[model samples]
Target: MIGLNHYLIISGLLFAIGLMGVVRRKNLLMLFFSTEIMLNAANIALAAAGHFYNDLSGQMFAFFVIAIAASEVAVGLGLLILIYKKNGTLDLDDLATMKG
Candidate 1:
């Protein structure tokens, strides 16, 4: 049967993958996606713990995290779109020399 350990392990793996993507990807969109993944991993862990402990607080926190992640995605995507339009590329290296 699946247990807390299993959930924790899965969450850990997901978080690691997200971290790698955030570190290695050069695209701004991919970086945002990676951050979302990490947030989801935290949500999963929180929900799992809430279930295991029969408590509501962890689940509530997970909901809050989800809301925050959604807002972050919306804002990040908007900014990325503007940046892409202005620069014509999503490459981080190319954006490094950006000036106002």
Candidate 2:
């Protein structure tokens, strides 16, 4: 039967993959996606722990996290759109040269 350990292992793998993407990807969109993946991994772990412990705190925290993630995505996408409009590209390496 699946247990907390299984959930935790899956969460760890997801978080690791997300971390790698965030570290190695050069595209701004991919970086945002990676961050979302990491956030989802945290949500999964929190929900799993809440279930295992029969407590509400972890689940509540996960709900708050989801809300925060939603807001972050909205703001981040807005910024990305603005940046792409100004730079005509979403490549992180190219964006590094942008100056005021």
Candidate 3:
């Protein structure tokens, strides 16, 4: 049967992958995606724990995390697009030169 341990392990793996993406990627868009992955990992873990413990709080928190993630992706991508249009590149290093 699927259990809390399984969920936690998956969550840990997801978080690790996300962390790697965030640390190793140079594109601003990829960094945003990595952050979303990390957020999703936390949500899954929270939801799993809620189910395992028969408590609703964890699930509620997970929902909030999802909402926040959605908003982040929207605003973050918008900013990335603006940067790319202005700089002609999505590379994080390129963005650093933004002086306006």
Candidate 4:
């Protein structure tokens, strides 16, 4: 049967991929997507652990994480929109001019 180990392995792999994406991508939008991916990986792992242990605690914690992630996305996207309005591009290097 599918087990906690399998779930953990998959979660770790997904988190690594997300981290690599965040590190490699230059676009701010893609960076946000990568962060979302990492959050999802955590969710998967938490849910799996909750199920394997026959407890609701982990699941509830995952839900809280989901809520926080959703809020983060909302605020992040709003800022992105503002940034896009102020600047014509979303490139990280292009944003360097904003710093002192």
Model 2 per-residue lDDT at 7: 98
Worst 10 residues of 1 by lDDT: 91-100
Stretch of 10 with least lDDT, candidate 2: 91-100
lDDT of 3 by residue, 45-99 (tens): 9999999999999999998998988898888889888888888988877756557
Cα miss at 9, model 3 (Å)? 1.1
Model 1, residue pairs in steric clash: none
**TM-score of every candidate:** 0.93, 0.94, 0.90, 0.93
Is candidate 2 or 4 superior in lDDT? Answer: 2
Worst 10 residues of 4 by lDDT: 91-100
Roughly what TM-score does model 1 have, to 2 decimal places? 0.93
Best-to-worst order by TM-score is 2, 4, 1, 3
Clashes of 2: 0
State the C-alpha lDDT per candidate: 0.94, 0.96, 0.91, 0.95
Q: Any runs in candidate 2 off by more than 4 Å, and if so which?
A: 98-100
Where in model 3 is the C-alpha error above 4 Å? Answer: 98-100
Better of 1 and 2 by lDDT: 2
